[model samples]
Target: MYQLAPNIELLFTEAGDYHDRVRAAAAAGFSSVEMWGPTGVDAPSTPKDLPALKAALEETGTTLEAQLAEPRTQFMIPPWDHSEFFRKLDEGVEIARELGTPRIVVGSGTGFGGWKRQVQLDKLIEIYQKAIAQIDGSGVTLVLEPVNVRVDHPGSLLDRTSEAVYVARGVDSPSFGVLYDIYHSAVEGEDMRAELAGAGDLIRYVQLADAPGRGEPGAGSIDWVERLGWLRASGYDGPIGLEYYPTIESAASVRHIVEVAARA
Candidate 1:
């Protein structure tokens, strides 16, 4: 069976504060939750009170599934500067350790405007290899996310799951993997089965939002029952993150997903 982790950054807007949002998720019966980053800039700024957020998680008995690591700073593509990227990654690792988060999501910046495709890909592999070395024993897994260019994240170099899988395969480290976002894959017109076949065990984390609108599961055209069922059958027994924008009240918007998970 697959576990569900709500992305508190997008969900539980009824509660204005970050810690309160964690509380809201727990109140809604979610035992695990995910977020964009510790800085809170991705959704809101939760930078001031991580201890309070930790306390809320402890109080509510909630566990964090994963979080993005300095998403604003692009590391996977372009100029390929390892200095600032490594610095931010160290900071992110410390925060993850503090919060007991096991995985960190990474974004591949826009493709190099003037570089050759093969050269860019080779450079990306080198960057990730060095990054994996930086966090060699941190016990935190880094997941490279491929955002779709069709509707969101246009100009991004790593917009296809196959490319992410290829990068992960080249890195070939247990600490490195790909973050397979179902919505992004669907928007890219990828056959999930085929792409996932290539990804195999390199998929360390999974996130979801309905395509076309990036809303609640049932709000879009994707078949939640079928796709999620495919995930289970494919041997991916990991948390499926709820990273959608709510179309209705936060709690109400997730009811359909909860039902589907229960039946799944």
Candidate 2:
């Protein structure tokens, strides 16, 4: 059976506060939750109460599956100084350690206008190589996520699963891998089954929202049952994060997909 982790940042909004959302998720029968960043001070900041968030997790026995290393600056693109990026990463690592979160998500910022794609890819590998060094022995894994450009992220540097896999292979560290967001992949018209097959163990994490609408599973065009079943059959036994907007009540919205995932 697959483990379900609700993205507290999006789901459980009825609870109002981030900490309360953790309790809400736990009450609704979810054992784990994920979030964007700790401080919530990133672009389009969510500024959470870290103390309360931590207490909620401890009290509810809810595990923090992962969190995004926020403010996705131009770290992966050209003129790649990555100085501030590393500093933020250090802070994020400290927070992750405090929260007992084992994984942190990262993004490939927009591509440089003047640089070739190959050069950008090389720079990403170099940057992540340094990133791995920075977080070495932190016991936290870094998951590189690829966002879709066709709709959501217009100028994102990395939009393909193949490219993410390539970069992860280049990094070649046990502590670094890819986060395959099914919603983004489907939005970009990717062949999900083939990509998952190709990703294998390099896929360190997975997030899902329905395609076309970025809503709950039944709200979009993709086949949740078939696709989720494929993920299970492919041996990806990691936590499957629910990262979507609810068309109805959060708890009610997730019931079917949770059942589908359970069967998968």
Candidate 3:
């Protein structure tokens, strides 16, 4: 059986502090937890917060697997000048390094303008190329994710899974890989297993969130249990992320998500 981490971002809205959230996650029997944003969710998690988060992980034996840069806060843009993009990316690398986590989820912001769209493509590539080089010694990897434009994110600049993978390879670094999100990919109308296998050695992370209702694991038709089997069949034993919008209480939704995965 694989270890599943309950995402606390959607859980425990009643907690007042950041550490309270981690503590709740630990109490929930989750082996790991993930959250978005460095601040404004409560206190800004700085280099200082890492030790408390670390202690919570230690006390609970839970891993802090990943962190989101909060939507539209940092990085994630098309056609940004190389200097500006790399600067933000470097900051992300620093966050990952300080937290002792290996991966940070990268979002593609809404499309850019002024220059031809094609020029933005080249700039995006250049940003990745330059920034990834800086993290060579840091051991932090960037995982680019594609979001759906139809239901969840309509104006998302990156829609196709193939395009995201292409950009990942275009970045051409050992650490640069795509975070293959089945939910958004499914929303865009693609065979999840086929696309995942197509990624082969390049797929670094796999996250799950269902469609239609977009609730906990079995509340929708994502077939998470079977999909998990696909990941196993394909030889991926790494962390599987639960990035869903909760239709029920966050903690209750987590219980249900865990139950579904367990039954699977």
lDDT for residue 76 in candidate 1, whole number 0-100? 43
Per-prediction CA RMSD (Å): 1.8, 1.4, 3.4
Candidate 1: tens digits of C-alpha lDDT, residues 1-264: 567898887899789777899999999889899987787555343563789889988899888899887745464443555687788889889998988899998866875568887677676788889989999999999999999999988888888898888888889999999999999999999999988888889989999999789999999999989998888777788888999988899999998889888777
Query: Where does model 1 exceed 4 Å of error?
Result: 40-48, 71-80
Candidate 3's C-alpha runs over 4 A off are: 40-51, 70-84, 114-122, 260-264
Tens digits of per-residue lDDT for model 3, 1-264: 556655556655466455667778777767777766543332333322666766766677777677764333233344444455455556766766666667877766665555565565565666667767877888877788888999877866678777777778789888888888778887888887787777777788777777766667767877767787777777777777777777776677777557655654
Off by over 4 Å in 2: 76-80
* lDDT of model 2, residue 147: 91
Give the top-scoring candidate (lDDT): 2
lDDT of 2 by residue, 116-190 (tens): 998888778888899999999999999999999998899899999999999999999999999999999999999
**Model 1 reaches what TM-score against the true structure?**
0.94
The collision pairs in model 2 are 40-47
